[model samples]
Target: MATPEAPLREILKSVSFTQFPLRVIEPFFVADKIVKPRLYIYPSFAVHKETMANDEKRPMLPTFDVKSLYMLTALKFAKYDFDIAYTSEPDASPDGSLPFLLLRDGTALDFKAIMSKLQQNSTELGCATEEQPDYISDVDGDLEMPKNELPSEPVYRTMVENNLLPVIEYLTWTDPVGRECIGEGKYLGSYPQIIRNMLSWIAATDTAHKLKLGLPEYGADAMVLDGEVLYENAFRTLDSLLVLLHTVDDSRLFLAGAPSLLDALVFACVNVFLYAPVKSPVRTALLKSDSTYKPVLEYAVRIFDQYFASA
Candidate 1:
C-alpha cells in the first residue's frame, strides 16, 4: 500500500499490481529469450498538477530523471523504446538510491550501471558511439568509474557534489518555503500529515548528513541559520561556475563541449533551482543575479530548448 511508515524503497520495490492502482507496463519480447522494450523508473519533480491528478498513488519523481533521460536521448545510435515509471524518493536504489531500470525479470539496474551496460551493449552490437559534431565528454556523475577525460570534470564534480547538490538539498528539505512546497506538492497531497512531515524530516536529516561529509564549511550545525550559510556557499561556487560557463564555445554548448553527463546533472539541478514552486534562498540568489547570472540562466534555457522542448 506504500504506507508512510515503510521505507520508500519498499514502496518502490514491490512490483505487484495490487500494491497500488499503479500501472504495470508490460514488455514485448521479440523472441522466447529476447526482451524488446525495458521498464525505466525515474524521479519526477512532484509538480502541483501531479498531486492533484489522483487520490491514491502520489509518488513524486526527482529532477534527477532528466540526467538519465538526457543520456538516453543523446545516444542517437540506440533504438529502444523504454516504458517509464515516474517514482518517488528518497531513492532506495543500490546506487546511492537514485533512479533505476527494471528488467523483464524485474531485475533493477541503478543509474550508472544502466549507462555502462548500454554503452557496452552498443559496442558489442557494433553501434558506433554518436559522432555528434560536438565532442562533449560522456561523464555521468552517478557512475562509479574513472573521471571523464575532460579538463572540466574536477570543476564539474565539485560544483555538483559540493555546491549544487547541497543547495538543492537545502531548498528541498531545510528551507521553510521549500519544506512547504515539498509537503504540499510531494507528500501532504497524498499522505497523512504525520507521514509527510516524517518524509520532510528525513530528507532534511539526509541533507545535513551530506553536508557534514562533503562540505563541513557550509555549516551543518543549527539548520535554520545553516540554510542561509549553505546558500551563500552554493552561490559562491556558482559564481565561479559562471566564469567557466561564460568561456564555453560553440563546439561544446555545456561543460566540456557537447552535452556531457555533467550537463545532464547540472541541467537537472538548475531546472529544480530555477523552477521549484518555492522561492528558496538559492532561487532568490538567481533572481538577485539580475543579469549577473545571465550565463547560468541562458545555459539552462538552452538545454531545455534543445532537449526537453518536446518532453
Candidate 2:
C-alpha cells in the first residue's frame, strides 16, 4: 500500500494582525482548533516607537506589537505563542519594516516570554528610550478632586434606574429586535436610540409634551432646565450601569459573569457613552448635573480602579 501524501496540509491565512482588536481576537485564538494564522503588517512601527519614547514610565505603547499586548492581557487569565514560523526577506532597513512570522500550533504560549521577546526585539532595533509624557501628570493630577465637589448621588441613581438598565436589558434579551441583532453590532442599536429618545424628551419644553412623555420638568432650576438635564441623565445612567456590571457577582444579572462575552458587550456600550461627543442638551445637561452625579462617578472610577489598576 502506498503511503498517503501527508493528507494535504491545510493553511489558514489572513492579512490582518492577530490583535487588531484584543478582545475579539482573545476568544477566537482560544477556541480555534484548526490553523488560524494571521500575518500582521507593522505599518505604524515608527509611530509606535515615538509614542513609547514619549511615555517613559509605562510599558511602550505596542502599536506594532499589539498582538503581544493581547497575549499579555489574555495571559492575565489564559496562555498563548512565541514560535517564529518564518521572517520576511530583510530589506535594506528591515529594522521596523520587516514582518515577523508567527504560527499557531494550538498551544498555550508563555505571555512573559513573548513580551520579553518583543522588548528584546525593540531594543535590538535601537528604539528603547525613557521620557514620560505630560498627559500622565494631567491624569494623575485630576484624581484628587474632592468628594463634596463631585456630582450628586440621587441624579446618578435616577440615570441607572431610568436609562442604562433598560437599554442593556433590551440589547441582551432575545425578543423581537434582539433575535435579529446577533453578533457584535447588536449592542449599538439600543444606546443610540435611548440617547436620541432622552434628548427628545429633554428638548420638549412644553409642560404638556413633557407630561405626555413622562419626562419631569426641571422646575425653577434654570441651569438644568436650560439643557444640562439630558447629559446629567446619560452620565448618571452610564456610571450606574458600569458600577452594577462591574460589582455584581451574580451571573444572572449579566448574560455571563466575569470573562464572559457580556463583559465585553457592556464595557463597549458604557465606554462609547463615556467617550462619545456630547451635543446640545446632553452637553449642557452634563455640565449642570456633574455636581449631582459625583457619587456615581466615584463608583465608576473605583470599579475601573479595582479591575484595571496595576497592583
Candidate 3:
C-alpha cells in the first residue's frame, strides 16, 4: 500500500547521511558505488564527529539507531573501491538530494531483502559469544530471585566501597535492565576479577592510543580538550561510563557483553586517531617498549583468557 514517494521519504530518513558534513559524507558516497545492487547506506559516529566539529548547531546526541545504520553502511562500503563526488555545496535536486546509482540491469533490486541479510551478518559478527556454563548458571540463579529482592544493590554498594564506582556506573548505564536492578547503597562488586582485568585493558589501551596520536590524555578526574577547559563543570564522562558497566546486574542484557552502541562509541572515540597515516611523538611514547600500558595489555590478555576458559 506504500507509494513511491512515501518509500523514498522513508529511505532518506532512515539513512540520515545528510546530518553529517561533506568530508565524512564523501567516503560513504564513494563506497556506495562499489557496494552495487543499489542499497541505501547510513553513517556512523565517526561521521557524527565531523558534524559535531563543523556545525555548531548540530544536536549533541543524534538518534542512535540512525547512527548505527550509518556505521553499518560505512562498513559495507569499506569492502569495495569506487570513485565518488564530494561537495560542501548543498544538493539542489528536487528533494535537495545527492544522486547515486543503483546496480540493476533494468531490474529493480529488492532493498528489503538486502537490508535483512546485512543486519543478520552484522549481528553475527558483533555477537560472537562462547558458551559459559558457570556464568550462565549464576545468571540463571539471579534471574530466579524474587522481583522485589534482587541482590544488585548490595553488590553495587560493595563495589563503591572498593573504589570500583567507574566500572559499576558503566555497567548500569549500558545495561538496559540496570535501571530496575540498581538500588540505593548498592554497589557492583559481584563480577569476578576477570571483568576488572577487561576494564584495565580497555583503559590502558585507550590511554596508550591517545598518547600515540599526540592527543590530550584523559584524566580520571576531569575532561580536557586541547588543554582548554571545554567541559569545566562536568565529571569525567569515561569514568561514568565504566561505572555504569560495572554496577549493572546484567552485564549482557544489552548487546550481552558483546559490541553494542556503547562499544561502538568507545572504539570510535578512542581508536579513530590510529587510522591516520602519520604517527605522533606522543603516540610513540605511549606505544614504546617501556610504556605504562604494559599492565593494561597484560590485563586484557588475562580477561580474554578467562573468557575463553569459562567458555
The digit string of per-residue lDDT tens for model 1 on 1-311 reads 55588787888777676666566777786544314224344445645553232222323323434444444443322333344555555245567454565545545667676667543332221221354211112322222222234676656655676777777666666667777775445534467778777877787778768765335564655565666677777777778768677676423456666445566666667666655666665655555636577677677667666655665
Against the true structure, whose lDDT is highest? Answer: 1
Model 1, poorest ten-residue lDDT window? Answer: 133-142
> Which tens-of-lDDT digit does each residue in 1-311 have in candidate 3?
55576666778778868667655433444432232233222111222232233233422221122222233323222232222322222233223322231332323223332333333332221211244222211222211111123234334333332332222222222222321222111122234557644644454445435433224445453222321221111124334434554554323322114323233333222222222112322223224578543332232233323322232
Q: Each model's RMSD to truth, in Å?
A: 15.3, 21.0, 22.7
Off by over 4 Å in 2: 1-257, 277-303, 306-311
How should the candidates be ordered by lDDT, best one leading? 1, 2, 3
Q: What TM-score would every model get versus the actual structure?
A: 0.62, 0.23, 0.24
lDDT of 2 by residue, 10-101 (tens): 22343346666656433444643434222232221222233222222332222222232233222222112222222222232124322332
**Candidate 1 overall Cα lDDT vs. reference?**
0.55
